[model samples]
Target: MSGPRKGKPVQPGQTVVVIGGGISGLATAALLAAEGHKVTIVEKQDVLGGRAYTFSEDGFRFDAGPSWYLMPEVIDHYFRLLGTSAEEQLDLVKLDPGYRLISEGASEPVDVPAGRQRVVQLFERLEPGAGARLEKYLDSAAETYTMAKRRFLYPTFQSFAPLLTADVLTRLPRLARLLLEPLHSYARRYVKNPSLQQVLEYPAVFLGASPFTAPSMYHLMSHLDLDVGVYYPMGGFARLVEALEKQARDAGGTIRTNVEVLEIETAPVTSRRRPAAVRGVRVRNGGGSVESLPADVVVSAADLHHSETALLPRNLQTYPERYWQRRTAGPSALLLYLGVRGVLPQLEHHTLLFTADWEENFKAIFGKDTFIPSPASMYVCRPSATDPDVAPEGHENVFVLVPIPPDPGLGGSGDERLERAADAVIGQLSEWAGIPDLAERIVVRRLYGPADFERDYHSWKGTSLGPAHTLKQSAFFRAGNVSRKVEGLYYAGASTIPGIGIPMCLISAELVVKRLRGDTSTGPLPVPLRAAGVAEGTVPKGTTA
Candidate 1:
């Protein structure tokens, strides 16, 4: 696909520095540069894609984070803004039997197919009258999903006016149904079977909260899976990173890797009425020397807590360390990336091995004492099952992820703990998936945990998916995208509004662009403006001067 056509340049647009080269940072940079701004992305890692980075060794390739691709429309919307489409740039293949679920002590694994009717049939097989109930449940879920996309996902929360829209008021009843109950309780009201209940409630776990604790609004995730469908790019998530990087570069956004942002430098406002504004970032260069890169505006798509506590001055931080200590974090993970020499015919492209004691498993993760439970629930992804390019001719690339608590103590001294957890995961997979001597077949193996998240991504409390989607930590209650204490400094990532996942990051980027442009409309760019192309002093309708 060709790059976006360059528009009439501004004589001197703002020099915007985006800290972090993750998806959100790249998307923000691309849009800003396309609008005639000078954009640069600074990433600490050797590679550009933060959590979505790909690594290859001995002909085996693996995506380090975010394996699932559930929301395609969000991604398509991003590409559309650049006058392109995801289909034109990436090879996307929708999974057939989307995933396989292995319940503890169950005789057979349940395969969840792509379409709604097929999934309903699977539900019926599990319980006598569940198919009809599932149909009802999904119909409600579809309505909830629609409300979310229209009323919640797209809009910026800078003011309360957006919440008073006619569309949102009309959907208040459905929104109440979603917000007033917990997901686990809501699902139980529809389905009586234990396994079917697990299937309906499982999506909440993806957001790093137990179904019992996560708000029922997240039932919308079921629609994303059963209705919208699950997909994987042919080359894994790494292809997405490559596409975003290309889009950013094509739009004249420069990315500098191995540059660690040590602090955000600021200048006092010249006027007493104005707040402090960003001057630049102080970065540690590859040679371990400090250098400053000046900017008119700064967008931090890095970890929210890291940005507030470590990067900004105490006086400029909006959220204090005590504020973070009181907040709830999403689950951290024990990740195992294994290069196996032989193929496992029994496993599907994606499989979830759930423990027998579901409540106990959650207790182990979110309870005060955080540790890996016996027979822990785990997710395994074999990308090579669908794409042969990720592994050698006779081999498979296996990714094992087990959710654990985000405990700071886990990071300070976690070697012995992680080793024990890895052994438990391997043994569980061996007995459950019929992969005997699983450890012996490993041609290569790398283990990552809370400490790795802290070291590599600077994740707060080593949480992988950002703050938990609890009642207090979601929507308007979540961290604001624009900083109130500092002028020309903004945030866009999992920690900000519209919350977690790849789709949310894309939306977050758009939100930041809207805030920067002073736009209030929660919709895609107008077709006429996109076609006519951007020009100086020609801010689109809904954007302020």
Candidate 2:
């Protein structure tokens, strides 16, 4: 479906300073550079990819974040708009058992195979009529996913026009229920079996939400992993970040590392004007020199809480400290990076271990009186099962994540409590998942907790995935892409419009472009600019881009 255009089109050579070197920052730089913007990305860290940063220790290379490659179409489309393709950039591999699921004291683990029919058969075996239930559930999910992509996800909801679209108007009743009901309740309406039901529940955890609280609109999440298929970029997800970095540079954008943005500088548009216009960023370089990086536009791809509260003044802030008082932050994690001595046959490339009491575990993470869950459910990724480059020869690369309350009070990396939590997780996996020698086999280990996230990413409440995808924080309510209190200030990434995950970050970058281009099309713009007024300079004339 086509959308109407409004707002002013971008001029030829406006200067843009993109704050952060994360995926969204790199992507936005690449896009605006193609439009002839004098684009520069300033990263506080010495390396790029923000959370997706990679490190090599003891010959075991680790992708510090984003292990799953769930949405290939979003990735492919994003690269396509940049005049490249994911297939052209990265070597992708599809896994047969998309992921493995294990439960405490279960006789056998469940393998969610790649084929749809096979998954349905497994569902039926687990619960009578569940295969048909899964089909019905996914059918609804697929429709919702498609509608969201076409209408809700793509458009920069700077205006209310997107809300009145035919697709949305027709489904107002269905969407209202989705907004009101929680995911766990929605899933139970279809299947009663605990094992089969868990298939839906686990995604909510990774999404930084509790199944009992997160909106049912998120039920579409299962359709992505269970039905759409899971993939990996043969080396690691960091390789994808490297590809984006190269693409940004190739598009004539400059990336400056080891530079911290001290403030988002602003000035009044006129002496009488109410909202200030973004002038540039105040920065402190690695050499300890402070200077102003002047720009006509500034896009903060950093954490929204950090950008609004720390960078901008309180008067110019869109979301003040008082605002977040009512908002719910997503879960923070206790991250364990382990390099084991030998391969572990019990785990898959992607595996999920659920405690017998996952609901209680979620309460520990998201409830008002938050605490760490013991005998906790966790996610383990043994990428060495497929990607050999991540680990050393005769060794396995293990990454364990246990979701915890997003409280910075829990402390930083190497903190005693955090380490004890990691230790408990290791022991639980050894007993529950049948990896008896898990602890002793460890040759390398590192623990990262909430405080580490706060120190490195300036995350609000040290949350790893940004704000929770609750009803109050979804769609237009998530935080607008463009600022209302400041002119020429825009936001992208997991913090703003369209919400979380790698694919959403990609869309967020595109939404920033849409806002700038005044191209308010809800559907994704076609590549090569077939129309007279398409994206500038990214694609060449003719020859089927």
Candidate 3:
């Protein structure tokens, strides 16, 4: 599986040094390797899948980051590009009624069903004829998503040329309208129930914005939920990482774990054509080995600012420190992975416990910039319920997350504070799910907050998903896949163009490879040129004068 070659091969075996083992880096390596180039992914951690990585404790498995698997088609395409399908590599089952959302107590939980017809029916029951209105709303969402996927998503907007097409220019009005309405206002027009409205707005929170302020375009997520359908990989979300890791290796990409990148060396003068290219990377391992790996192309899937400031030399810095500091970032998550000993029948595959004071909770985090000691809203996922292999029989694997500001400034999430907050959340979960006395039912539990994300992943300011998708920090406004100042340098991750989420990160990888190769043909290229590519200085076999 390879992209069709357009011009002669631009550069051969251009040893691509990808710093980070997250899905972004792995996807980058896969695309580059498929193009007949030698690729190596260096990760600081002992495992692949950065924030999406998994950990096992005593027998219970947990995804350290991103538990939900949205947009199955995007993942399917990744596998297709790697010479297989998601079904062939892994087992995927669709979740019915995607999630359950409740307030303080759930005498009657708001069941958000899966698929368009079912969800519409559920809405109709909640509020008369609301389903038909939702269907109409979703039809519009589908159109927006189609436009977004084709016109905006797949293209590498490293420069404006890709986005300046006549087709896109004509679509500006729709795009502007989509961006104009607030998600809360937009949803309220269709659905009357406050609880259903909260359900529709959950994905915006994932973008690290409040529904009242988050763009109306976010309603596309609800459309994605009902249209695309919520799905679970057989062994849980971690299986995605494993599958991706295999693809990279299969494409002849090398992955080195426990190797932390310390510095990036780049050329000095920026040429208008090629600009400055990355020379190599210096790394340190736990065993105390410090060494530099040579490369012609370097793509960092790590935190954008960290790679620019800490890993690259001062003279090679692209953007100033003040730039990143001023940007709003997605909420840093407070995560809990719990292994329950007994049954909790009331809960579904996904659950959102809404806070009574939603606006106040948001203001506390985004506006006031403080951790909500008692966050009104939380997301809970029961992967084991859908995928039995994730845990032992009769036992359950649960992942709960609450969004908070990046700052833990004065005292951090102290022991007493985190415990108290977690307890309060569990209490809400219990009441919502109709599970009695959940506090005593836990056999195993693990808690992670801003401190853990910062320590484990080196996430900038302990942010969970990367920079917030604000107007100024989105699309062309965000970092380019190719370096603006440094040549042979690139970025592929949630922080870069196309924004956050697993699918976007995967595409970010593709964008980096596209920049290096400069073509978008489907399938593999000529064999001889593919076989003779060089790692650094030499021009690739297919290049022309």
Considering summed lDDT, which 10 consecutive residues are worst modelled in model 1?
Answer: 1-10
lDDT agreement with native, every candidate:
0.83, 0.86, 0.75
Candidate 2's displacement at residue 527, Å, is 1.3
lDDT of 1: 0.83
lDDT per residue as tens, model 2, 1-545: 11122557767578999999999999888877766678999999999999898998999998898899987999998888767789888999999899999976567899899978888898999887999999999988888888888888888866666568777888999999998999999999999877778888778865678999888988888888878999999889888899888878877789999999999999976652346988899999999999999999999999999999999999998889998888899999999999999879899999988877868888889877999899888899999999888998999999998889999999878799998888999999898777899899999999899999999999999999998888888887788777777878889989888888999898998888888877767888776322234445547221125
lDDT leader: 2
Clashing pairs in 1: none
Clashing residue pairs for model 3 = 2-523, 4-521, 12-534, 97-113, 97-114, 264-311, 276-487, 277-487
Report residue 74 deviation for candidate 3 (angstroms).
1.1
What lDDT score is found at residue 104 in candidate 3? 54
- Per-model TM values vs. the true structure: 0.94, 0.96, 0.90
Q: Give the lowest summed-lDDT range of ten residues in model 2.
A: 535-544
Q: Quick one: best TM-score, which candidate?
A: 2
Tell me the alpha-carbon RMSD of every candidate.
Answer: 5.3, 2.7, 5.3
Q: Which stretches of candidate 1 lie over 4 Å from their true place?
A: 1-12, 270-274, 411-414, 527-545
